[model samples]
Target: MSRSRGSFGQIIFADQSRIYNTSTIVGRIRVCGDHFTKNCYTKTILGIKKRKGGNVSSSFVRSTTKSGRRKGIRSSHADAAPCGQDAPEKDVGCKSRIVETSMPYADHDYSQRPPSLEEQLQEAQKTIACQEELLKLRKNRFFLERFQCDDRLIMFYTGFKDYITLMAVFMALQPTAESMLGWGQSLADQHIIRKGFEEQSPPLIDQFFLFLCHLRQGFLVQDLATRFNVSQATVSRICITWTNFLYCMLGSILVWPSREKVNELLPLSFKNTFPRTRVILDCTELHVKRATSKVLNSETYPYYKGTITFKSLVGISPYGELTFVSDLYMGSISDKEITQTSGILSLLEEGDEVMADKDFFIGDLLSPINVRLVTPAFSKSNRKLTPEEKLQTQEIARLRIHVERAIRRIKEYHIFDRTLPMTTLGSINQVWTVCALLTTFQGPLF
Candidate 1:
């Protein structure tokens, strides 16, 4: 037996002893196994039959079957054999061999066709909608309800004593806020500017909460927007609207105590040392961002603070209520000038005494209004103060410290701790005034 490759690339085993000598041209032979046929021979092409007048190529091989007859190899049909009953079957002495090969896309083949662009887009839209719903579910929807039970959180976030007081103030302001045409809206237009997007604006109470958060927390507009789930523009509008609204609403209330009211609330310490004191005045400076213009820079630069600042005079009743907050002036302005221009003198009457720090040289200004100035005595000509003057200075110092405490309360808002941006210049005065007034709600300073 010998093994060789046939022209069709199939392995062929032939018995050399059965070879027959014949003048015949044999072409490639293909053998397939078949069990149903007796002869087991299907269509066959014996290459080319040799004839007397026909030419046979020498490259062709000659072979014969066991009967010593020529056998053809090439078939006229070039198509592959089908695997069913209709295909011609051939029988050989061997069983059929099963060949296994790896398929490249076998595991990756999909049962259905890939989705089209429209289908994918629709799926993405559905996912986004679901995500939005989940976000809304996770976030607390009501600002007031969320903090109503937590007074510390209310204080931390809005500087209110508790939810009750917060709501009380809101209730007082709500009527005017609801009745107004809108934020800075004209009476003729009759259009009210809503706090947020029309479809998703927070309730009026929540809008008030948002504004309080902005003021007390000193949160940026973007931060308030994110916390409230509104646009930055909406937060800005809310802040401006509420600032003006509060400036008008709260400012309408008279904070300056009258002479009898001051005497009624005056503390014993003031009564013993300075029995006639009406109010204690002090000058405080707030840091402000540098301005673009040279004139602004020069005018706002406070020599004491070494930075651009806004100067305001804060006056408290002897008992520590912040009775007066002067409009912000340039840092470069003198305390005497601020006192002269702050209009506090007009509010004072004869026999009313004003107590202040030694830096205030406004005794001349007060004298014209017939208001007495009580301040710590300064040594003159390097002379030591007398024992009585020393006791008087100590008493004045002890009594004047309350005004500093009042200023500290105002500064506790934290918004004034940092240098204010120039953009807030428009409403910063109102902000300062509102903060000063809100401290009255913190209970008595004494």
Candidate 2:
């Protein structure tokens, strides 16, 4: 009467050993007879039913042949009784025990009986996920949804499209890039271009979209050609043509409003800070490759960049719109020279004030023309700026940031942000002009 209770037993039930799961079970409880009395208890197979709340109970069955042969565990009513019930051919004093617990994701070597309910549910879920992925669709990045989300994103990749007079109405409001892209698609509908000998390639929408990408991304002509599946010559041509096209389309659109117009439409930000401001002026530079000619290299090279660079002056209206952009100048040239010769001051009216950085010594120059220069106070080595001067500097800086942002928007074209090749230097002005005007597409800066 020695029972090894609560101990697991390795029952060599029927021939198959792998049909049961090793991990999916909660726990296994086994009952064994005395170790010394090997045949004292009947060796029989049983079925265990697991409940949702982690309760489990076992039922014994005569799952073996009467001839003393091995057979699989069975739960059929003909062979066994449910838990707490008796088996018809129970061993004289046999008791069954659980051997092991199961692990999650345990694979069951399915034998004769069907799989459990839990396993079936898992398979169905996986199938549904796959079917959903197969059925889903996505939009083209340039033509629809992506554009509407951020118009600035489209301007960065594909600048304003070829102008149609009616397009002015669409440009007046800041719509989602998607709506504009949709409108652009409808506008370019049925339009096409070709060269007689070449194989047909991607359409102009993609071509120009790619062109804008190349401009803002600064990808090389050879790389762009490969990406668009066009020849290097085509890439070069599109770059030059589109640069000229955009400049022609957008460059002349920026108008220098009269002083009265400026006062009438002055935004609250400028009105509160610098009411008399005609424009916020700032200078920017672009790095370029050293030129072939020594004079060209000498002229373009500047100490600030440690490399050849091009410099230009940018001015934005009080409402954060670009009103002026000087022609590209060699970096070595002084800002005053660019300002003097660039003809920007000629646009200013008497009594108009130009807000600028502290560096611009254009006050004496503007004074003669009856135009005033508003700049941050200079901190001389002999004496620091007074408290009042410091406060004026902060206010000026606050207003000046809008101009810096305007310049930043110009550089956003990315082409301006990269090292310029000598070949493209000829059209750098067009590139600059296009980027400046492209700001309109970015919605109102204010």
Candidate 3:
């Protein structure tokens, strides 16, 4: 029993420690964050009293030694708890806490404990072991390094094209596996790319496979990085490099045919209905990330997309074969300017009719070349079109669906489905070129 100097008397706690000074005691009640457990408490827990009519019937006391370190506790209180904190239960203790901040790298807990020398050594050894395993996997072999347990792996990553088609593309790009064994010999002999000082990187087949995997599924760069056990930057570099490589190698596969060739391969549907039509052409836009530079924003902004974009003129043959794909132009350019500069008009033969949407007002542009521009009828003086003009527009619309389908096929390659990144905008034209050409692999557009 203890007494104070004034009218207050001390209630002696037999086993529990009482608050030494009432006014001096820090009165802080905490609600435990752990809903899964009742035994969570603040780091510093002060003893509290449970009273009925000013007499203490029971006391919730947390004790510590002279060292001032709290011990394990297992008790629950009926008294009110502070915001976001709960008193530990009578059956559960600090030892039963779901999140023990005492440990290093606790999950969902920001608490961190500095590593000891032994832990640091173990981590270094683990890193070294991983590096050694990676080196073993990435050794100079081909065809079965990164993936490729079977053909299913190929289709899952590189689209639904057959293995033969995939192998053809791979071989065309690789040309000689011998070059893959060395450096740039495959592309160097072909002069597609010059040789450079080789860096220790993944094999050619693996790189090609990686590129295909990215294109086929449009996986995020970070995901590819983790899959390949490399950094996102490395995955990005591989994507850009292989994008250039595949586009350069495979682009010629979908070449614009001679007039005779185009005529010979024309599907009867086009030959009978739209005989004079050589190519259906239109301008398409791909939304890209907004640039920080005002000039860049203005240059890339297209009113159609209501955002920054890259505009390309797509020309498809009568049977849906891509006749030509132009380089990406700034969205700011007029359709007439793009048509004149895209080298598309040059591909046109004299007397060839260019079937297009009404927006492609290039009849005067085509007139000097002896080429014709055919589009739906336009109203004059605010009057409706004649019946003949309406029938003509229906015919053109029915035939023009093929070009739209061709564009849809290109856009199906998910990379172009979303807002493109500005960082890789330099290589985006190549990516676009590749996607456009890949439609050929889908076979005759009919």
Best by TM-score: 1
Instruction: Evaluate all candidate structures by whole-model CA lDDT and list the values in order.
Output: 0.75, 0.64, 0.67
Query: In the order shown, what is each candidate's alpha-carbon RMSD?
Result: 17.9, 19.9, 24.0
RMSD of 1: 17.9
Clash pairs, candidate 2, are 22-102, 23-102, 23-103, 29-98, 30-97, 147-177, 147-178, 148-176, 148-177, 148-178
The sequence of per-residue lDDT tens digits that candidate 2 reaches over residues 116-174 is 99989999999998877755533332332335556565544555432331135234422
Better of 1 and 2 by TM-score: 1
My TM-score estimates for the predictions, one after another, are 0.67, 0.58, 0.60
Clashing pairs in 3: 30-85, 31-85, 31-86, 32-85, 32-86, 74-90, 75-89, 75-90, 76-89, 76-90
- Largest lDDT belongs to which candidate? 1
**Whole-model lDDT, candidate 1?**
0.75
- Tell me the tens digit of each residue's lDDT in model 1 across 385-430: 9999999999988888888999898888877877899988999999
